[model samples]
Target: MTSVPHVPVVVVGGGQAGLSTSYWLKSRGIEHLVFERRTAAHVWETTRWDTFCLVTPNWQCRLPGHPYDGPDPDGFMKKDEIVAYVKGFVAKVAPPIREGVSVERAFRRGDGVFEVKTSEGDVTCDEIVVATGGYSDPIIPRMAERLPEMIVQMHSEQYRRPEALPEGAVLVVGSGQSGAQIAEDLHLAGRKVHLAVGPAPRCARFYRGRDVVTWLADMGYYEMTVDSHPLREGVRDNTNHYVTGRDGGRDIDLRRFAREGMELYGVLDDFRDGELRFRPNLAESLDFADRTYNGINAAIDKHIAQAGVEAPPPSVYEPVWRPDAERTALPLDGSGISAIVWCIGFTPNFRWLDAPVFNGAGRPAHRRGITECRGVSFIGLPWLNTWGSGRFGAVGDDAEHVVSTIAARLEGAAPAIQAAE
Candidate 1:
């Protein structure tokens, strides 16, 4: 039998979250190893489309000890630029990351240490950090399986460009940021596009003279904790915004797309016998999105007035709508819709972990980054403690917190081990 090498910590996944944790662990003088199934920052390098850009601004790319201090902080980073940025950070920090090493299994041993079985070998660690990020597996609805085989179906992750898709009208399911952006991409490429609008909050790229994100940061919105937030449950489970980073950031809502000659449909309900069905609440969903946008602007305006701060003139966006056919159901045969792209977001994957640290939904069950399982921690989960916990700008803070907890636990265990010896 091969003797398992022991380390103080083992961090799985080498994306932003794992790298951040590695940095903190090194700073605290903790002996650790980081295992990445692919190259470091693999998702940003391969998963994103060619024209994809960071939805958040460049300034929010805050990793531990490496903040974005470039000339265009407000500008969004493209896919290549983002990959380069992560690479630069990794070079600077030089985390002990074993790339292309897949972690097959990770479970606690009888001796209380974690045995992480990997392609290389098994590693025993006192603690384990799962920083695989929130977006794990692409979530496609069951209705997708019912779609006709003739329709070229794909998840947003597999979509590379508009020209690459089958030549016909494209039906994009789920009107979150990816759905809205992909619909717009196809429309610009001269393809007839139909967007299934979901209820997602919309916000103008710029409010007053500052970026919407900047205003939110100024208002301490990002600092709001789950316990103290007014709409804690909603904020925790809210979908992505109907906005895009292309062309210097802009709002991409159902109304805007409708005015731009894209057919808007309500939530996708079912598909049967080559006919797709949708709910008959397209207008109501658009109205709800608008109200949410307006309420956010109203709150920003109120803050400016109460703070007595001089700001730029308010920018008003008039909602535009074009009357179209009531498309509750459409036959896929001759509708010119050749492709269906599902952008319904992602779900976390923890199948490799044989620990009882997951909730009913298979998400890591933890308050902040500390789980019920001792010495097991999770970072890069949405609403782990605050609104920004999973975001690039705020993941470093969560990583630091988890590292501190791990350090304390290790310190306590050292004395006990000495006593046992």
Candidate 2:
């Protein structure tokens, strides 16, 4: 029988997080292999819309040693540019990777060695970094099945451009970052848009003088960990504040979209008998979003004042539009809505891990990124170290932490991390 190929370490993703770990591992002269079920930066290349760009500025695109040295550091990278940047990192680190291979399962054997079952073959390793991150599997609500078959339905990931959609009015459900930005994408292309606003908060793109992200980073918001947060892990489920780095960056104001003739509704409640129903909360949801937007500005203002930094005068957002009345229901049979875009976020799927590190909901349970399971851990998850863990900005830090934990184990000096339960 042919023996399975083995390595000291195996990283199970090819995205920035996994490659970041690979970079550190290589620096330490640790032999490892990366298994990417698809090509490098697969989601950024295949799933992103044509006009998709990073909501965060390019300066935060730090991948271990290879930070963003692009000409447009403050600018958001478009889809193609983003893909190139990731591929560039892959080239620089030159991680030992098999692009088409998939890690189908991972578990620790009784011997303390790890077994990684992959699509192509199996491998044994002393340690494995589950860097696949939290997001997997595009989610479409079951309510979509009730909609008329003729109306085109696609997840936000599948949406490329407005013109590509069916020629008629479009209804975008769930006003999170993706939902709001996609609505803007369609609205800019002159498509009549109806947006279903959720409870997702909104934030300003630029504050007093500089980008709000810059202010937050300067104020140490990125370093705040889950344990330090008042809400603790509850903050993990909170939808991201919707803003845009498109066209030099700006706030994604759904109310402003409504003022500009796009129709806005409250959270979608149900679809019954060819009619879509919405809760009577459009006004409330919009108000909450604006409050969060201005709230962030207020925090930034306080930071500026305390730090004695010169900046433009503080300002608050005033509502530009309000719903005349709560829109309760709309019949789709004759409603000009020809396309429905589901912008609801993805559901977490980590079933392949088959490890004791997961919680009841199947989410990986860890202190920072270190799990109690010997020689097994996770990285690149939201709140893995801080709010920035799930994004390009703080992934480097998380990767470094996970790699350090792994190194400590290799040296038989794993300390506080190994004791995490």
TM-scores for candidates 1 onward, in order = 0.94, 0.96
TM-score of 1: 0.94
User: RMSD (Cα, Å) of candidate 1?
Assistant: 3.9
Q: Write the per-residue lDDT of candidate 2 for residues 66-158, one digit (tens) a residue.
A: 888989899999999999989898899999999999888888888888888999989999988888887778889888887778999999989
How well does candidate 2 match the true structure, expressed as C-alpha RMSD? 1.7
Using lDDT, give the best candidate's number.
2
Off by over 4 Å in 1: 315-317, 322-326, 413-421
lDDT of 2: 0.87
Taking the tens digit of each residue's C-alpha lDDT, what string does model 1 give over 339-420? 9999889988788999998778767777677887888889888887777788778889989988878898999942111110
RMSD values for the candidates in order, in angstroms, are 3.9, 1.7
Residue 200 error, candidate 2, Å: 0.8
Worst 10 residues of 2 by lDDT: 412-421
Candidate 1 minimal-lDDT segment of 10 residues: 412-421
